[model samples]
Target chain A: MSGSLLITFDKVWKSYGQGEATVHALAGVDLAIRSGEFVAIMGPSGSGKSTAMNIIGCLDTPTAGTYSFMGIDAGRLDRNRRAMLRNLYVGFVFQGYNLLPRTTAVENVELPLIYRGAAARERHDLAMKALAEVGLVGREHHTPAELSGGQQQRVAIARAIVTRPTLLVADEPTGNLDTARTHEIMELLTRLNTELGLTIAMVTHEADVAAYAERTIRFLDGHVASDAVNLEVAQP
Target chain B: MIWETVRLSLLSVRRNVLRSFLTLLGIVIGVAAVIAMLTIGSGTTEKVKADISKLGSNLLVVRPGRPAGPGGPGGLDQATNPLGSKELAALVAHLSGARAISPASQKQVRVIFGTESLTSGVTGTDSAYLDARDWKLVSGRPFSDSEIRSGTGVCLIGETVRQQFFGAGDPEGEIIRVNRTSCKIVGLLEPKGYTGFGQDQDNVVLMPLAAYQRRIAGNRDIDSIYVAADDRTPTTELLPRVEDILRDARRIPPDREDDFSIRDMTQIADAMASATTTMTGMLGAVAGVSLLVGGIGIMNIMLVSVTERTREIGIRLAIGAHEKHILIQFLVEATVLSLLGGIIGILIGLALAGLASLTLAIPFAPSLAVILLAVGFSALIGMVFGFFPALRGARLDPIDALRHE
Candidate 1:
């Protein structure tokens, strides 16, 4: 695959509270990732991996230094502009699935398109395509409550990819699943990365989950402890 | 986008049916109360106007004394400043807009016919009295001009008097005694229900003024004069002319109040209407408070909803929903709730007003402007009260919200 930088962070700092109460969530972080690469962020609780992912997703901005997405300064965008950027370019899959309650899987997948002001017929067709991509074609009508944990996560993933975003960020997406379901979810992510050439940045504490990625960035005490490529997995 | 937001709002409302209904109840009561009060108030005004019209349009009652208690002018007593034939003649001569003028003198007398006797008022007036009071003859003719001039003992009996003395017999040509004076019944007056003053209009006998002066009243004094204005003339315009004429006829100085009073029936009708309108406004204002209460209730529920749906909002935000979209969604939901309440309240109000109007024997008059205003006002209330909560939902921090349990 051709390598082109998609996201870059230069000396980014994010701190919460003020003065003596301040806590550095992400301290002096610098990193760069290419398009179509699958990277896993590994850290202990409150080690700043989630904070970095947030800045990369444009859900947040670094308090100091510059964060850029596709050569544009993402940290300088206003709230509304940032929201538009996320709608057009970023998709998120949460650990809790976060599928809308009382809504069908297909409708949940249609959320991003709705914000994009897509016509109803097109939104429906695209949502069907997205659900089918995650092996959820026949289960579009089922609600989150009516499905198993794995199926719910699949619906969440379908919602994430419905916009055909350039980047899909997953925050411990398999944290709530059992071992078999976790393997199934990781395989789905890998397949999306390989076949669609989609850029993925995932946060997880499990070593095996990080092993599935082409590269891993481990964080310790709000700083990047290690950034290395995995040579074991053969490149296409 | 708006349609989708509406759909979402409707779905959320449906999910919490009981809470939604309870919140809307306040608005329902408010709108219903306002409509019902105004409707009933208008109906009562209509009834009063109808009652006044029954007394005949553009007619003024001239009494020697001021009309007493909450209705007419004051000062002077009837016993001392009584009117006579001269005053009647002056009214006929000096007034330009008067259609008819008739002087009346009344005396309570007992009438007997065919061994049946009933005590009733004997009113002495000429042929012009019928036109002035707008009375009609049900059977037989009114007294002839010659009969009135000659003081003939022929009289017209009202329906109540006929009922009391005739006993199903034809009393048109029968003789009856008015306190020992024999009189032939020339005609029967039409039924006139009740007067606004609660007096029965059909419980009297009408006779020629000359005959009444000679026999029933035993005096040449006329108690009052009834003046009917010309068709094109308004009573308000005719009143001042009559007052001036009376003042000149009675020889009263311009600096002093008149020795008599003129009561305009239309003015009384207008006063009653305005009073009811004020009361209706007050009632509607009181009811409007409940709409505010209902609006507050909506805000309360919406705040709780925002808190409960914090994570959902965070998910939506993370998925790329604008702040304004969330704000509009909640605003529309609140408006829908209030609008539903408003529509139902209108229906209930109409039904209640109809029932009240029927029971009170008044006309049902629902104002379309008022209904539209109420609907608009309720929608406004929803927007005003729903704003803060929707703003809170819109401005939530995505990270913190998504982390909310």
Candidate 2:
């Protein structure tokens, strides 16, 4: 079965600095991701996976290539328009969870909806539903400091999905958790992918975390080393 | 959307309560300085105006010779040519615009009443002196025309002199000694309070010109002439005509500088008012520098806030907040701080002005327009000074900010 293409990168090139001090963060990247796929990108530090994630999330633009997200040229859009695209279509869950301090879990989850100019009542209801989906039903008033590592990630996930974006991009979503918490977060992502048909692109260094995705892509230096379907994960 | 930004700003301010109050202290002091200076300045101006008006409206005092140095209005020893009754009569006959004219002579003399004694300014003037100087009788009656002509032993005691000589007892008709001469007190003068120069206006004794010249001065010389203009005549029109009349009466040559000088009380009032207004403006400007310093304080704190909340800004940007939103948030926060300080400062300034007015015995003249301008200026300062910090926050690269420790 096939679905609509959500992201396309054709010969994407990105670099930092200029002249002899230049460093290529991404080199001639060509990739396509469909609307309903769960993909994991694996690479060591300095492998340029983070750069690719940033480009794909519309937080940055490619220096010399075409990056089209939802048929709009991500490389050509200005900062404000790119931010607009990110607000409407892409959600990011960072390794640090990145919850605003002194803010309640409900308010944190309501951030994206707020950026999208949602009415207060609707934003509240949607945020409540999002929090409940992450199994944090009665803990909406707790601040990030009050929540455990896994619970904070759950709140972050609620925040990411409240706007109902087409793609959820997570970079090391379980990096800071214990193994048990990591497994719980993995299970939650797997359920969200399977039950809600949410497309996900996750970056991880751990093979066990990579095993949960339907497909895996490995990077070496600034280029992809391998790309293949995960037969072990597809059957499970 | 604006309401949302304001709520966020208030939340951020509430987050660091102590820091916010410290920052507001600068603005509070600045606004307080401005309001207090302006309030007191206008109050002083009102006092000066009232004191000058008490000398009477549309009035002119012709004093012999020009003032010398800082010694005040009596003139130099070399310019000691005084007027006579013949010259006074000539001015009265020639000046048609004059409603009342009086010749004045003065001497400082020790007066004795009951067992108490004090030195008082004993001024010798005609009966029209009360009309020319706008002096009112509080009790008894003024000296009759015949009493002034014959130089009778009769005098009017001012409020301060009355208090000094008679306390609360009736001083009217009581006999009091002026140096060696015993003069009966004919009337009590209404209290005129203090002059602009802080001199007591009620510390004088008034008598008919002939009586003062005969008993106090023992001379025929008149020191000054007081003239009250008609209600229909402005001092500008009345002044030159009076000068011409004086020059003709004194027989001064056309090529020579006039021996006497005419001081228009209205002109003096206007001059005093302008000087006070100028001082108020200069003080306000000096106070405004402190406001600018206060603005710089706001800018400094806002810059620090932006740096401290770098990670928070990163989170907001990553969550798809527009740069404009972040800009508005910080700007509103700074504005709210300054406006709060401005309101508090106004209240404090009002209290200070009220206390000062009471202690100084002047009117409380708080101008609403000045208060509004100060508040508006503080807000404008917030925007002007908050801009750079807000721009720095807005223009931040999300990835760099997020990675910042």
The structural similarity of chain B in model 1 to the true chain B, as TM-score, is 0.79
State the displacement of the C-alpha of residue B2, model 2, in Å, after optimal TM-score superposition. Answer: 1.6
lDDT of 2 at A199: 89
Model 1 TM-score on a 0 to 1 scale: 0.84
What TM-score against the true fold does each predicted structure earn?
0.84, 0.90
Tens-digit lDDT string for candidate 1 (B1-405): 778887888888788889888888888888898889888887877777777777766889888875466755464554558888888999888889888898888878888876888888899999999998788998999989999899999999988887887656677898888889999998998888665456777888989999999987778888888999998899989999999888899998888766787889778778877887788788878888877888888889888888999999899899898999889988898888888788888999989999998776678999999899889988998888889999999999888889999
Candidate 2 lDDT over B1-405, as tens digits, reads 778777877877888999998988889889988998899999999998898889887898888885443646545357557878877888878888788998889888999987899889899998899999889999989999999889999999999998887789899889999988999998999999888788888988988888888877888999888889989889889889878987888788899866777889999899998999899899989988998999999999999989998988887888888899789888998998888888888888888989999989888999999899989988988888899999999999888888878
The fraction of reference interface contacts (C-alpha pairs within 8 A across chains A and B) present in each candidate is 0.68, 0.51
Clashing pairs in 1: none
TM-score of chain A of each: 0.97, 0.97
Give the best candidate by TM-score: 2
* Best of the candidates, DockQ: 1
